[model samples]
Target: MTQGASGRDGGNSLKARVKTAKSRTLASTLWLQRQLNDPYVARAKREGYRSRAAYKLIEIDERAHLLKPGQKIVDLGAAPGGWSQVAAAKIGADKPKGEAKGKVFAIDLLEMAPMPGVEFRQMDFLDPAAPQLLREWLGGPADVVLSDMAANATGHKKTDQLRIIGLVELAAEFACEILGPGGAFLAKVLQGGTDTALLARLKRDFAQVKHIKPPASRSGSSELYVLATGFRGRREATGEDGAG
Candidate 1:
């Protein structure tokens, strides 16, 4: 078959098409085809990124200016290390003997291969002990917190939305606890809209809250990112409230 521009037919070919095998489900075949044809996937492979998801963060940071040199960062659910890779590079974590030297701490339940300038921990962030452990490892409050975690989808839209919200909420709470004043939090959230209560809490705690759908995000997918900046620090109980 003749191919278009994206194929390897003497430099003028079309996207690669995956042929369905007898044992492969149609859904699986389609997914493979999409992956093979995705330009971002090909670019990621060429650029040595761990996953195509890296471009999402790269684009967001380009517009938002969230990552910076010499900033301490924590990346939750950083398996496959795409976001962690971006964070480390942006903050100059790998730079040796430079003023821009920074640190990146990454944690996830899934084991990830070690990357220079990132300290990886294999543990669930939901563990009660996790926050303190991360703090200890970081040596101080983080200038930024990032989370790209999502629960395995059950194929029910509502259930998936709720699970994603719950994960982001937990990550936000953790950010509030460990973030320094003026810190920023970025997390993956469903596009159906964040829960009202969670939105309210975020607004109360942050100076700015925005939902961004980066271009790298699939157009048909519900994935979005919530960027919350300027943490106000934890609220201290007033006397009357404490008395109660």
Candidate 2:
């Protein structure tokens, strides 16, 4: 078989999976037998979340309390927007209660239809102009920046890890650019853990940078999220701003 352009040979390859299949249950067979059969998938359907991943945000927020009415937020890599949905619901972005107004700016390379009180932007976040557009939309800095953007990984392991790290770094830098004092940043990272420099940078900027794997996240997945809260709003935190 030819290697994919990204060099990540799809996941687990169909042949390897078939070779291992034997007396698996129907549930296992159908799930990626047709799709991923996670119990959370079933629960998400009943609970009305866009995807099972929504619960991950809920679990993280349960401890952090990042969501609030009237806070401005930016959701990066927000296609099939599960996190944006939760932010909207919690912040009254869905219904707009009196004096309680919030907006979730959802951005992705892929197109999403639309969500009320959520601003959708289909653009490469790497674009130099994207931040300005977002700032204009929010009318200033934001209270939160959430990123779930992982590059389409090639099964090659190290390359994929590096790519994801790069994305995380970009998100962190962007968070620093746009977050107000006491702002928070949430991002996905791998089990090998975040790079030391990245971790160190977060620690210096936020009050605390902690790794959390929410209960709603599948036990089998190696993914974990880094929650960095309480932006110091200092010069060091805004290095990318070039105010030096």
Candidate 3:
């Protein structure tokens, strides 16, 4: 990826434009142009982040105050690890041996390069064994679960929205299962916000539930995030288990 100076800086400047290429699809060309002009993309490169998405988590956490030292975190669909990177840094995951700090366990279908403070696992997070494995690695239930996953766009608005909602629902379910009491869940949703049913479920399980659009997120994009904090412990089919 190439970085270009953005008008977002104090200096006045024109947005960079990409010339149409015969070999490139129009969609790809437009995406390239957007990336070129995106201030966060350039900033991410300067700051050594995996992607521009890191700033979204940074902005959200700044207000929500979720990440903390010694907290355990799970990052769903964490390939390329932008959010994971932020979580590790915020939670002091890179502290030296014998110095207590948070742990970050990340999972994705695609392989991620190793990072000092993050443990990356390549597999479907929906696999039956995934929750157990992450808990084992963390040595306990997580303080937070984050999902920045998005389904491949089908170009149909309703269908795409539904797919995004479905992914968030699944992530929320996983978080409930793996999070300790007072845990938090953060995941990507669409512009319409979370589904009514999902929002009700989150409200029941968490003390606070709301949708947020961080400044790092594109203003015109449909992307929104649903945040649920202060988990009330997991509910059970028969009886709820006491979380440590």
Candidate 4:
């Protein structure tokens, strides 16, 4: 992958302009302009990544050291398979005959193109049977759970934040159910970070929890990632211990 292509250095790169077209909406025109000039997009094309979003996971994993060979990973909302690609490479999931055999199970509502190491299920992760199916595919509890899921933008800030939070919460709950002891969870959230209630619940379950915004993310974007590491263990569904 090409270096020195951080989104923060956009001013240093030559800008690309999109010609106005009768068919293109204002939103699409602006999106095209941004994509055309985004160095990460260009680097993704050159490096054969599914999308520039792959770099976000790469940056986070570099710091957190979450993806290890021989580990089991669950990728939520893995459509387009950018994060899955990075996870597969880092965990050596694609290795055909290596002692360090890793596993990656991906779930998304939309269809994803197949990759060598990834096992994909096209279904709503909220479905009651999804967790069982994922465990069946993984053959064991997950070491890392990743969620880059995001709701469609309604152009309303508060409403959008709520939707984003709702997705993150569901993903977090699923992670709690499937992750083994000392596992890790990472999910995309908003600029203000996770809500208080959700953060408190995460703090109760994880030894270390924090928010991170990788340089690959556009500086102007409100997107951030919440990372929770050192999961104590799976909580009993019935609250057997009554430890809130």
What overall lDDT goes with each candidate model? 0.85, 0.79, 0.88, 0.87
lDDT winner, 1 or 4: 4
Better of 3 and 4 by lDDT: 3
The parts of candidate 1 lying over 4 Å away from their true place are 1-10, 97-100, 236-244
Give the candidate number with the greatest lDDT. Answer: 3
Provide the lowest-lDDT 10-residue window in model 2: 1-10
Q: Which stretches of candidate 4 lie over 4 Å from their true place?
A: 1-12, 97-100, 237-244
After aligning candidate 4 to the native by TM-score, how far in Å is the CA of 140 from where it should be? 1.4
Residue-level lDDT of model 4, residues 89-204, one tens digit each, is 89998877554479999999899999979999899889988777787788878999999989998889999999999989999889988888889999999987479998987888
The TM-score, computed over Cα atoms with residue i paired to residue i, of candidate 4 is 0.92
The digit string of per-residue lDDT tens for model 2 on 111-184 reads 98787678899998888888888889999889999997777767677777788888899999888878888889
Model 1 residue 78 lDDT? 95
Task: State the weakest 10-residue window (summed lDDT) of model 3.
Answer: 1-10
For model 3, the stretches where C-alpha displacement exceeds 4 angstroms are 1-12, 237-244
Displacement of the residue 148 alpha carbon in candidate 2, Å:
1.5
Model 2: lDDT equals 0.79
Q: After superposition, how far is residue 36 of candidate 1 from its true place, in Å?
A: 0.5
